[model samples]
Target: MTRSYDEWKAAAAAMEFDGRPVIGGVRVAARSGETIAKTNPATGEVVSQIHACGQEDVDAAVAAARAAYEAGEWSRAGAGFRRERLLAFAGLIEEHADELALFDSLDMGKPVREAAAIDAPGSAALYRFYGEAIEKAEDLIPVTPPGSTALVTREALGVVAVIVAWNYPLEIATWKLAPALAAGNSVVVKPPVEASHSTLLLAELAIRAGIPAGVLNVVTGRGSAVGRSLALHEDVDMLAFTGSTEVAKQLQQYAGQSNMKRLALEAGGKSSNLIFADCDDLRLAAQKAAFGSFYNQGEVCSANSRIFVERSVYPEFLELYAEAARAYAPGDPLDPETGIGALVSEAHADTVWATIERARRDGTIAAGGTRPEINGSRAFIEPTIVTDVPADHEVHTREIFGPVAVVAPFDSEDEAVARANETPYGLAASLWTGSLARAHRVSQRLVAGTVSVNTVDALGFTTPFGGFKQSGFGRDLSVHALENYTDYKTTWMQWG
Candidate 1:
């Protein structure tokens, strides 16, 4: 099921965005008249060009969102009414799965199958789950003592600025958008300039799904321009972002300088995958670990990049893991058979290569340390696994954010826990062990927001996902996300 270049091109051309990007039911371009060319990272080919948003565009979008929120037609409407609209939106996303998947593949270099199966389906499920969850949300618990009355209600926090990263643009955008909109907040989305096409299209779908005008706005531009404006805009009530820790810091400063908007940042991670010798399923663990790190060209923030194997089975585990890594070769993203694809951009691929080089200079290369050949001039990199990397190596500590895994041997469970928690990040970790007691002990010790026992990336829409420490705070994609976009109002009244 390998799709040819012509097929991919045809698909991309046929994919429509329901006219132009929507803002308050109006089709509008950038007021500045500037534009950015959307290039396919896999082939360095220009897919399309979008009007580059400037400060004026940001203001307009925010004004639209603010007006929507103030009008209370969407946010202040009955929860049941909001629920119906969100359900319709989810249905629309499911109906347009092919177009959304194709656009994501072309814009982000992810395999079409993966995008269609995992990313797009996951997004639809998120909206559906949150939509249903919000309907059941009510003030059931009273805050008054004895018979005294105090009502606890959840109020929308007005306009939200959701700034998503380029790695998994549509997926992460839906992660923020689903819950925010379900909680009844008008959204001003600032998608990464590198991959804004699909996001803009999603905004169109929202409009078609009967989302009130101005409830969801899409602004496309560089982070310095539109992103900064959204974060600093006084009308913006909250900011939900997913990207690097450095950028998250800058966003925090922006939020502070502005109106102290609520900030939900899901940032960088240097996660570890621990494989104990007692695990009966070394083969399964090896496969999951390899895919967990190398999937999405290692663009995942919660990738299990640092692997710690028990000394007893270290050699055999490395062999199996390397074999699994080789199974995921770089291929054309449009091909359904392709398990792994390009690295988003040539510049990003170069950065990944440089990081691998740095690791090799400081540590022993285990398996892949070279680039793979591609049919087109795309940003493709071979999946790599390195061993004998010191704990202090930058590759082990920092977020390489590419298809590279650094394996290190550990003798005991305590050592594995220590190694896992050595980095500034506490995003996610994975443990593979057969013993229940050992699983409980290790999971408790791991200083990460999400820990997978005998699993890799089993992320679901119902679970609260976020990070701790420098990985950034706040949650997304669940009831926790609903709370992030809402403010609690406690009303106290004295009986006359």
Candidate 2:
């Protein structure tokens, strides 16, 4: 909060992508010697030139990771050492939080203050949580016949390749990286090419935190090149990814076609905000629902794009939601007063509006449907509210991944639950009501990985986050995510 816009500008101007690519604990250039331009989504200006890696780079990274794993350097350092090292990494993340936050904002066009408050610190917190988790974890004692003793222990999956999306670059990647490393697996992180600066900086910080070289590697490029190669690499023992459903499916296919590597995916979501008739604090519920739908310019995978309000309160809730939306008028991300930052990229912004345009054909635009006047192409969309949307409309059923939402009404509790579950995605949902019995009953009925009662977008360090159905499987966050990076091996011995 103390840093000014000039400070952020200076930091961005001085950033050096000169590290190229880090492999085996050293910075190296890609075999192809290729580079990709990362642009600020707000200004459409080149932020940095990141070394683009293809099949060759992926091969080298995976090889390095495999060698590191087999060397028993990080993996065999034992849980206590890993814990200390991970904590050190977390400390560095905190130490450089301001710069890292600026990197995220400048690279992806998130509001600087928002990025600082949420993404940067959250990443550090995740690392710290995983760091402590490894210390308390224990091997299991198994039941056995009287003459035998059996012990089951979890072992790291050699090399984990993580692919994350452009939105929430640092936060989401940390969700995958923390547990993977904590479980003693080496990793090759492929952050979304459009926003790689912060991730690249993060990798450098990891080394400073004392993670051995090759223990954590970052390869930046199009998903088609680096991501495809890494996912299809046989030496990679596991793949953990957070991105679009289509891409997640592709990764699974790569794994199946290659080594059948273990996969943990947290993909797309068309989540719902279900407001009941007896909702507590109607104004706050509406406001939170709006925030849930449009935060981060609505770039969240779990954005509550589909809002179902009880028929009795739908109109009032809609009005309050519209009021909240208006407050988030799009503006320059670097401006401290600005609320709605630019969309991640001009291309993605176009895709978001295209979905909104399609929704207009069959839905009513309640508020803020038009594009804002911004410097860059498709840089921002006014926080939008759509109503009278059919249950099966694209806006209702698909993930817009922008500052857009569709509000509809439901008559009964069963109807509300039914409407919420109608979509193929069941990632996250929120229920607002004062009735304890109804909350429990409806929560169970709604088919989603995470459910919030009397709240919206309720997520943190302690719990698992994921989805059901086409939204993808497995979880992120929490110690629960550690399961993806390790497998249990049981040993049985006969005693004299």
Per-model TM values vs. the true structure: 0.96, 0.97
Candidate 2, poorest ten consecutive residues by summed lDDT = 10-19
Looking at model 1, the pairs that clash are: 42-378
lDDT of 1 by residue, 1-496 (tens): 4346577667877875422346786779788878887788878878777778888888888889988888988977887888888889888888878788888888889898887777877788888888889999988456666656887888888899999998898899999999899888999998887788778888888888888989999888889998889888888999999999999999999999989999999999999999999998999999999889999989999999999999999999999999898878889888766768888888888899998898788788888888865756548888888777667888888898899999989988889999999999999999999999999998999999999999996677678888899999999766888888998998877674
lDDT (CA) per prediction: 0.86, 0.86
TM-score of 2: 0.97
- Residue range 106-143, candidate 2, lDDT tens digits: 77788888888878888888888999998899998878
Best of the candidates, TM-score: 2
Cα-lDDT of candidate 1 = 0.86
Which pairs of residues collide in candidate 2?
none
